[model samples]
Target: MTGMKAFFGTFIKEIKLLTRDPAGLILLFLMPSAFIISLSLALEGTFMTVEKSVNKYKIAVVNNNTGHDGKNIIDLFEKSGKLIVLTNFEKTLLSEERARRAIIDSDIIAAVIIPQLDKNRDRRAEIKLIIDPGLANEVGSFLQYSLQQYIYISEIARLNIEKNMLQKSIYPQTVEYKANLGTIASNSGDFSIKKYYALREATTDIIPTSVQQNVPGWTIFALFWIAQILGINILGEITDGSFRRVKVSPTSERIWLTGKIVPYFLINLLQVLFLFALGVYLMPKIGLPALEIHNTGALVILTLAVSLCAISLGVLFAALSRSSFMLSSFSAMILLLMSVLGGIMVPKFVMPPVMQDFSMWVPHGWAIDGYMNVLVKQSGIRDILPAVYRLLIFSLLFFSAGYLALKSKLGRI
Candidate 1:
C-alpha cells in the first residue's frame, strides 16, 4: 500500500515537471503541425503534378504511306490517350535528319516512321522508330508493343475474312482492306501503354497524399524529439541529485521508473492526437487533402504502441547518458538516423531498395508502416498487427536494457 502511494506521488511529480515546461510542450505539439503543413504545401504543386503528368508521351508521327494499313496505324496512335501524335502539313516533314534533331532538341520523346506499303506484297510492312537516347529503350518498347497489338488484331480479322471468302468463293481485294480498318478501330483492349507511377503493391495503386505522408512521418519525428527532451530532463535530475533523493525514498526503483514513463507516454499519445487533428481538419481548410483515417481504432492502437516505443527509447537514453550535452547529441543522432532510414524525410516508396529493406530494422519504420496502412491502404486493425507487435517487442527490449543499466549505475552510487 505504501509502494502504491509512492508510485502515484512520483508519477504526479513527473507530470508536474513536464507541465512546467511550456517550451517543451510547444515543441512536442506545435512544431510537428507546422512542419506537416509547410512541407505538404511545398510538395503539392511539384511532385504530385509531375507524377501525374509524366505518363504522356509526345512523339512525332511521319506517315509516308497513304495505304489503308499505314493510315490505319496513324489513326491508332492518334486515338490513343497515352500518345500525343504531332501532325505536320507534310507527311514526310519528319525525315530521318529532322526526326533526329527534333528528338534531341525539344519536347519529342520518340518518332514513328511508317514506310510506304507495297500493294502487291503478302507481308506486313516494317515501321521504323527513332527515340530519344535517354528514354529510347522504354519508349521504343511501348511503341513496338502497341504496334504489335494493332497488327495481331488486324491479322485475326484478315484470317476470318479469308475464311468467309474461301467458303463463298468470292475473294475480293476490297473485303480484306475493309477488315484491316475495321479491326484497328473496333478491337482494342484496355492495355496500359505507359505507366506514369510504379505501384508498390498490386492490390492498390493510390499513393497517399502529401499530407498523409508528412503528418505520420513528422509526427513520428516529433515523438522522438519528445523522448530526447525526456532524456535531457532525466539527465538534469541525475546531475542535481533529484534521482538520488528518490532513490533514498521508500519508493522502489521499478515503481519510480514506471511512474516516470507513464506520464510521458500519455503526453506523447496526446501529442500524436493533436498533430493528427491538425492534419485532418486544419490542413484541408488551407487547400490540402483532408487526412483520412480508415480505421480510427487501429490508429489509436498503433499510436499507443508507438508512444510506448518512444518512451522506452527515452528511458534507455537517460540510463546511458552522463551529461545533458551527451544526451542531446546522442539522441539527435540516433533519432535523425532512424528517421532517414525509416522513410520519415522521404516516402519509403521512392527510397532506394537497399534503404527500404533497411527500414524494417527500425522501430520508427514499423510505426510509419502502421500509420500508412491505416491512412493510405485503408487497412483494418488486423492488417497492422505485425507492425504493432514489432513496436511492442522494441519497447520490451529497450525498457529491459535500460532498467538493467540504471540499476547497475544506481547500485554503485
Candidate 2:
C-alpha cells in the first residue's frame, strides 16, 4: 500500500527470482570452481609462490660442458629447490631439441643449455635459456632471473677460485643474460618482452602462485559476470513492460532501482565468499596451497565496493541496451574482454606494459588488484583503500550514467 512496503515487496520478489534461476546459480558457482582447478593445474609449473618452497617449477637441463662446470651449474639449480631440474625423462638424457620440444609441448617451463666453456677463457660456460612463449611473462622472467642469479653467483665463486690459483685477476663486467623464448609459429620464437612481471610481484612480500592469483582474480571475474545476469533480468522486465507498470505506482525510482540492486548485490557477495572458501578450504584438498588472507576487513570492504560496482555497471548496461539480443551479446562480450584485460584469465604480471595501463581504466582490474593486495601481498585495510575508492568511483559513475540513460529512454531522448 505504501512506498516502503512496495519497495520491500519488490525486493523480496527479486530475491526469489535470483534464487530460482538454476542457470545463473550454475554459472556463478560451478563454472568458476572448474576454471580455478583447471587453470591452477595447467599453470602449476609456471607459477610458484615463495611461501611454498617444497614444490618447484619444472625445467629441463642439457649439459654439454667437457668438465665439471656443467655439473656445478645443474647442482646450483637443484640446490636452490625452487627449480626442479629434469636432466633426463624416461631414462634418456635431455638434449637441447628434446628440452625445447618439452617446453613447446607444455611439459616444462624452460630448457637450459650449458655450453662448453673455453679453457683459455677461465670463465663459466655460456648458459642459454629456452623459454616457453605461452608461459606468463612474469613467469618467464622469474625463471630467467633465477637462472642468471645462480650462474652469476657461480661465476663469482669461480673468479675467486681462479684469482687464488693465479694470485691476481681483474673482475670483468658480467655477461648480460639472454633468454630465447619459443613461439607458437616457429616453435623457436625469441621472446623479447622488455617489461618484467617481476616489477609488480616484487612489491608483495610473498610471491603469488597460480592458485593465489586465481582465488581472487577469478572471483573478481565471476563477480563481474553478474552484470550479464542482472542486465538480462532487467531487460526481460523491460520487454514485458513490467518496469512501466511499476513506474505508475507511488513508489519512487530509487525504490525501483534499489529493489533491483539489493538482491543481486547480495548474490554477488555470496559468490565472492563462496569462491574464497574454495580457495581457503577446498584448494588445499587438491594439493594446492590454501588461500590465506592477511586482512579480512580489507577483503570485506573491497568485496562490498566491488559488488556495488558490478551491479551498478549492470544497471547501466540494462538501461542502455534496448533489446534482449543487444543486451546479452554486448554485455557478455564486454565482460569477457574486460576479464581478459583485467587480469582475470591472465595475471597483470603476464600482460605487457601498455595493457597493464589500460587495465587501470576498468573496475575489474581494480577489484582484482585489490583482492590480490589482500590475499597475496598481505596488504592491510589502508593499502586497499585506493582500490576501494576507485571501485566506488566506478559505481557512482555507472549509476549516474544508468539513471540518465533510463530517463532518456522513457522519454525517447
Candidate 3:
C-alpha cells in the first residue's frame, strides 16, 4: 500500500480506538459540561450578593439635637431608600460598647450620631458616622454618598423654605413692575423649551457572567486533557511496533502527525461548541444568566485558534513524554499551572498584579482574554486579532518543539 493509504488507514484505526474509549469520551464531553454548569451555578449570584450588601445598609441613628434638626435628620434617614433606619437604639443601648458590638456582629452596618449642633457657633453640622471597619472601603464609600445626598437635599429644602418665608415678608409690589412692563415687551419667535429626553440607563456593550468565564475556562482545560490520550497513543504505538512500521513506510512524519491531529482538533472544536451551547441555552433555562457574546464570528475564530494550540501542545507532550505515567503526571502539572496562570481557577481581576501580567505568556491566557473580549467586552473580530495571532504563534512553537522532540526520540531509536 502507498504511504498516503497507510496514513489514512492508521488515522481511521486511531479514530475507532478513541471512539471505543468510554473514559476518553467522558473526559472530552461530559466532564467539562458538568464543571461549567456547577461552577456557573455556584458563582452566578456573586455580583448580586455584593450589590444587595451594599444597597441595604442598617444604620443606627443617635439623635441628640434639642431642636428640629434631630427630627429632620432622622426623617431623612427614614425616607432614604438605601438606608434602613435602626431607631430606639439610643434609649435601649446607650453605651458605645453596644454600638460597636452591633457593628462587629453585622447587625448594623453603620451608626450616624446626630450631635447637638450649636447653631450660634458652628455653621455646618458635625454629624459623626461610625462605620463597620470589617467591611471593605466600598461600604464606607456608599455610606458617605448616602449621607451626602441627604445633606444636599436637606440644605436645598432649607434654602427653599427660607426663600419662601423671605418672599412672604415682601408684599407683591406691582407698582415697580408696572413702570418697566411696557418697555420690557419684546418679540419672541419660537421661544419654546426643547425638552430633550435623555435615557438615564447606562449602556454596557458586554456583561461578563460567571458562566461565560467558567465554561470556556473548563473547556480549555478539557481540551488540554487530550494530551494524556495522545501520550498514551504514542507510547502504545512504539511498544506495539506500529511506529516502527509507519516510520519505515514512505509516509512522512508530517503526514502521520496531521492524521493524528485532525481527529483531536475536530473533537476539541465540538467540545467547545457543546460547552458554549450550555452557556448560551441550558444555563438560562436553569435561571442563571446566559453567556453574552458580541461577535459570534470572533468567538469561532478564537475557538479554532485555541483548539489548534491545545492540539499542538498535546503533540509536544506526547513526543517528549515516552511513558504513560510520565505523560499523565507532566500533563496534569502543566494543565493545572497554566489554568491558574490563565485565570481558569480564579478570575484574572482578583489575581495579583504580577500574576495578571504573567498570564499573558500562556496560550490559555490569550484564549480566555479573547473569549472575554468577544463575550463580555462586546469586542469585534478586529479587537480579538491579537489574541488569535498569539494563539497561532503558540501553536507554531508547540508544533516546532514536538518535531524536534520526535526527531531526537527517533534518532535514539
lDDT of each: 0.73, 0.72, 0.69
Instruction: Put down candidate 3 lDDT per residue, 1-413, tens digits, no spaces.
Output: 57678668768987898889878686679888888888888886874464345435777776675666556656766775767777656459444456555655556766776666553753454666776532333556766665566566555555555565566657555222122222111211101111111111111112246776688789888877776677667666765677777677787777777787788888888888888888888988998766766578988888888888888888788788868788888888988899999878787756777987888888878788887776654567987899899999988999899878876786566
Sort the predicted structures by TM-score, highest score first. 1, 2, 3
Q: Where is model 1 more than 4 Å wrong at Cα?
A: 53-206
- Which candidate number maximizes lDDT? 1
Q: State the lDDT of candidate 2 residue by residue for 24-92, as single tens digits.
A: 676778888888888888877667532233223688878886555556657767887677889997799
Q: TM-score of each candidate? A: 0.65, 0.63, 0.63
Clash count of each predicted structure? 0, 1, 0
lDDT of 2: 0.72
RMSD of each: 12.0, 14.6, 13.8
Better of 1 and 2 by lDDT: 1
Question: What is the clash tally of candidate 3?
Answer: 0
Off by over 4 Å in 3: 1-4, 50-207
